[model samples]
Each structure stands twice: as C-alpha cells, then as structure tokens.
Target: EDLIAIINQYGGAIPETYGVPVEEIQKGIKSGVRKVNIDTDNRLAITAAIREAAVKDPKNFDPRHFLKPSIKYMKQVCLDRYQQFGTAGQASTIKQIPLDEFAAKYASGELTAVAKKAVTA
Candidate 1:
C-alpha cells in the first residue's frame, strides 16, 4: 500500500498488485523452504524511495539526494527479509573453509554436484 501510494503521489502508475502473504511465506519456511528470492520486493522498495525523493524535491538535481534514501530503504527491506526468513544471526554458523583446502577439493573434483532425485513436475 505504501509503495502504491508513493508511486501515485509521484504521478507514476502501476496496476494494483498483491504478493504472497507474509504468513504464507512464514509457513513455507516452517515447511523447509531454506531460501526465498525477493528481488522484486527490494526493487519496489527502492523504486518507491527514488520516486518519493524525486517528487519531493523536483528542483534538486543532485543524484545523492535521491540515492541516499534508496540505499536506506533497500537496507531496511534486506534486514526485514533476513529477520523474517530466520536468516538473521545465522551467518555465524557457517564454518570458514580455508582457501587452500577449498582449492584442493575443487582440483580433486570433490566439489562435483550430486544428482538430485528427479521431481515429477
């Protein structure tokens, strides 16, 4: 709603749209969805920020004036998604593999992909 409001306030047009509900996404996570791609959400947030900045300051030609808010908005989206997806604070769990060991494994073909079980779809 905020996105649509801002876009309309800036005289831009987008058809009214809806996305998967947050509750549904949370359910997906509970059902073993490890990752959810959300670039569209990020883009919408960024575009809203840019449109708002441009509309609020029409005479301001400085790009930084527009970009700073977009960066802030984007960061908020990323942080929100991380928290929602339960990925926040989980980066610390990744064990750091040494570069030499990683390279040796790659050279020995130990990094080869394991075939997946075929899906009916």
Candidate 2:
C-alpha cells in the first residue's frame, strides 16, 4: 500500500476516479497487490506512436531511423505502466518473494483470487 500510495502520488498509472481514492490503491499495493493488469493503454501507446511516426516521416526509407523514436516511445509506455503498477525498480523486491511459495499457497487454497470478478447474483 505504501508503494501504491507513492506511485499514485507521483501520478502513475492508476486512474483518479473511484470509490477508493489513491490512498486506497496505495494501501492495496502495500497489501500485496503485485500484478496489475494493463493492456489497452499499451496498445494505444504503440498505435499512437506509430501513427505519429508515420505522419512525421511518410516517405522515409531508412527503417532504423524511422523506427527508433517509435521504439523509444513504446519503451516509455512500458516504463509508465511499470510506474503505475508499483513495479518499477522492483527487481529486489521480487527476489524476496519466492514464486514457489505463492504457487504452493494458491494450490492449497490459502490464497484468494480475483481477475475483474463480476456478479449478477
């Protein structure tokens, strides 16, 4: 949660409108919300960057020069996603949490799970 708070405070990936504010998201991050799913934003970023590059250099012949900025833009998008998920510079933190342990716990029904769960009940 503390990490989430930090990311949110830094204006990272999390959207601003919700019942639970940025503080809550931060708390959730602190409470072991490790994986944040993001796809659409990435797609948009890549598409927009490519379109911009194309518009800027419509008849350019050199693939390397033309694609370089697009690649950089995509990298920035990924970095932004990392910031939003509180996973930037998280290599050491990940090493601390053993994947095997998480898998065992999940298998033993000791871990709760939800992926955008919805209910009509």
Candidate 3:
C-alpha cells in the first residue's frame, strides 16, 4: 500500500523508477498513470519458458524448439496487458487510415502542409 500511498500523495506527478507489482498495476492505471512498464515480468516469463524448454529436450538443436514456447508465453503476457489496460476490444476506436495513403500524403508533404503554410504566413 506504500506505493499506492506515494502515488496518490503526488497525484502520480512523479514517474516511478522502480518496478510496480502486478497487483498494484491496476491501481496505478486507475490513478491516471499514463504509462506502465511490465518488461520485467514479461522477461521473466520468457526466460523461464526458455529454460524449461531447453531442459525438457537437452538434445534438441533447433532454435524453433525453444522459440515456440517463448512465443506462446510472450503472447500471453501481451494479451494480458492489453486486457488489463482496457484496450482488448478497442480496434474499432482507431481511425482506419490506409498505410499507403498515409505514406503518400507524407511523401507529398500534404500531411504537414497546413503547418508549413501557417509557419510561413
């Protein structure tokens, strides 16, 4: 609760330099904290999966043997984070712009034309 207290006291004005526990991640999110790093947890999950896969088949020389489990574990972590952040079903909320059109506009300078015109005027 100490971490939550500090965050609440500062109103999340300060960026947390240390890793926040998973149990407290939701608290941070609810408190209006914009970004949270869960790299450590994901790394731990990947490392553990790799170790287990390697040990289970000591004679296996193919990289795919270990990578398969690693991918599964990493994917699970990513999905969990997406759900926790309330972005699991938010794809429709994003503007559906085509990549090629965006690239064309960028290349033609149309994307920033208004800003350029404003600056010159």
Best by lDDT: 1
Pairs with backbone N, CA or C atoms under 3 Å apart (clashes), candidate 3: none
Clash numbers, per candidate: 0, 4, 0
Q: How far is candidate 2 from the true structure (C-alpha RMSD, Å)?
A: 10.8
Alpha-carbon lDDT, every model: 0.83, 0.58, 0.66
Better of 2 and 3 by TM-score: 3
Model 2, 34-78: lDDT tens digits are 555445544444455555556567787676754676567667767
- List clashing residue pairs in candidate 2: 1-26, 1-29, 1-30, 5-26
Question: Global lDDT for candidate 2?
Answer: 0.58
C-alpha TM-scores of all predictions: 0.77, 0.47, 0.58
Alpha-carbon shift of residue 33 in model 1 (angstroms): 1.4
Per-residue error at 99 for model 1, in Å?
Answer: 5.6
Expressed as tens digits, the lDDT of each residue in 1-121 for candidate 1 is 4666777778778877889877899887777666698888888887898899998899999999989988888888889888887788888899999999999999999999776544432
Better of 1 and 2 by TM-score: 1
Which residue pairs in candidate 1 have backbone atoms (N, alpha carbon, C) closer than 3 angstroms, thus clashing? none
Judging by lDDT, tell me the better candidate of 2 and 3. 3
